[model samples]
Target: MTRSEATPLTIAYTATSAEPGVNIAALTDALTHHANSALFPGDGEVTLVVQGRAPVTFDLTPMRGDQIEADMHKKAEQINDQLNHMLAEVAAHSEILEASTNGLDVLGVYDQAIAATPQGGEIVMVTSGLSTTDPVDLDAAGDWQLNPSGFVAQINPRDIPDAQGRSITWTGLGQTSTSHAAGTTDPTSTRARPNSQQANKKLHTQHAPGPAARQALHDLWLNLCETSGASSCTIDDSLLPATPTTATNRVPVIEFDQVTTNCLGTFTLAADIAFSPNSADLTQAADKLLAPIADALATCPDGRRINAYGHTAEVPGSGDGIGLSTARATNVLARLQQLGAPRNTIGIPTGYGDTRPTVDNTPNGAYREDLARLNRTVELTITN
Candidate 1:
């Protein structure tokens, strides 16, 4: 599953009080920090509403006397104290419970409690990240010059006090790299969840690239050879399909009938490479397939624009709605941008959902693969 829809991550909260000094906004910020700061944390989302009076909550309890501020300095300890306790309580009964909190009320009595909790789910605090107006860059590009200097990633979650009457504490780790390598302050030092390590490990397991991606790679290799002055090249087994779903799929490789080389020029090309699983991420084979294009762009005059549009078969319950084709197109565009393609020169991606099918949607065994192949094509157009 994509990180957004992954399990073990959820946030449901509402503020009981709506007082200004209590700074529901500030408390929200603190709680967001708590959620993101956890070790081996899953992707989290939060929704909050304010009720009659704001309620303070936390994991660990803070000292008896302390002042509350938006910065969450002294008060953070109190909130963290309460939050820890609440997490334990909720985890014990309802594995998951929607948590929330209010801060700086001057009342020492039991302040925080969890309600409407989910059964058999882990209890995790939720909050938002700091807000900033900065340009952010995605790191899939081989070279980094394509991105702007300043980029932003934001997190903001609501604050909640724990079961123990104290406010929760959270630490915001600012300035993380998209690569996710440990920043200046090492991530190992921070406390993490029990499943965090195992979870990350499972996430990294390898899988083979999907068929459309492999075919696109093969086509790119042949395209490059024909364009370049090469004596001869062989299509390796790695580039061919291991199993054939149809007659065409069984072909060893989409090898050129005859190699041709004459004139060399640079042109731009774009396509929406496909994958098996429901994800936009490109596999290594996909990258290899596109490498020739990148190489041509960098060196050959005929280097194409390489729009990198995405496409998918029209399937039921796939949310293949109106804008979905457009989304697939944009996803392709983004990949090209990330690959260091000249940003200004490339055209915006456009999708043709089953609109311009190369074959009938109806299945007819071997023939069905041809139509699907044609529909799944990443149409490449060359221009000066």
Candidate 2:
């Protein structure tokens, strides 16, 4: 969700025993390696609470980054610069002075950076990319001046661990221009899980997709140009899964109405199941919206199957929309199952995070959250 209940962005972590030295350079690489995750377009200092050391806060106010890779680098640079300066000051002046420079507030909060400290305090950085500070425009994050002397995309997931004892992996949901290219490493490379990451892993355990579910899902499609309440509908059937015969469904055919192109990517849900930005949990109102589809799946013929498609608006610090989207589709799929849709009939959960945006999310382009809501929808289709 855009606004969390509480807890803000504080992430509590537990590491087993002591390991190697604190890898700040690796940390910087992991945090800014990709445009996705651990940062929100929000405001505030990035408060990193190591196991035992004083809590370290990186003020992100004057520092501006819509959570983009480049901007994150800028922010990371700010952090690195401040830490170095503080450490240098502590070495020269004897004790680091409490201060705020380049939008960082570590001295006053963490006491002061000494020449060295006791070890064993591992790290876990957390961010909704959000903050109490003024909102940021993700589109504009890239426009900042770059430090030509140092802007490298060399850090791989190996540098960071995903806390789950696994790597930073991306289950493909049609990703484009993604960092997921055939890697120098595997999908299971070390990556940070933080708090939200733990929840993401649980979603995949719900159900395992098989040939039966995959085949049945082909029946669902948004091929209706005359869908109800559509503003402008022009969808390429080739781009979508094949449309199954609607005659078998007990409920009225679910048609789609296309919103303006600026709203989001090409595919909009005909049913309009609204999911908040970055949220996987469904609401009671969402249950109402999905009731019909579930009802249809309940009475389907043997081997009948349906598919749930999830989408997210392309936004900065949006993390791997894949996990978020997959979590969403799984949540909706679970509801459909609860409503009597058979497990086999439920195809795989697919999430199309910001990678596939119909609308341009450039600076000032995604100003309105309502407009982005269309992208955060789950559409249903019959496979067989």
List per-prediction Cα lDDT, in the order shown: 0.31, 0.34
TM-score of every prediction relative to native: 0.28, 0.31
Q: Write the per-residue lDDT of candidate 1 for residues 1-384, one digit (tens) a residue.
A: 333332222222221111111122334443546444432222222322122123323323233334223344644654555555554554453312211222211111111112322222222222111111111111121211111111110111122122221122111101111222211122455643221333232222012223332343334323322222223322322111111110000001112111111113211122243433444455454454444444445543543454434444555444443355566556555555566555653565666655654335345332343234435544433245
N/CA/C clash count, model 2: 21
Residue lDDT tens for model 2, 1-384 = 443311122222111011111223333433333213324443333344432345444433324444423465565666566445534443464211111121111111111111111121122321111101112211122211111001112223232212221111111111111121111123353542211123233211111112111111111111111111122222111111211111100111111111111111111242233454356867665655456556656766777666667766666665647777778878877887998767887788788776665434443553445335434555555655
- Shift of residue 237 alpha carbon in model 1, Å: 22
For candidate 2, the per-residue lDDT at 207 reads 19
TM-score of 2: 0.31
Question: What number of backbone clashes does candidate 1 have, counting pairs of residues 3 or more apart or in separate chains?
Answer: 72
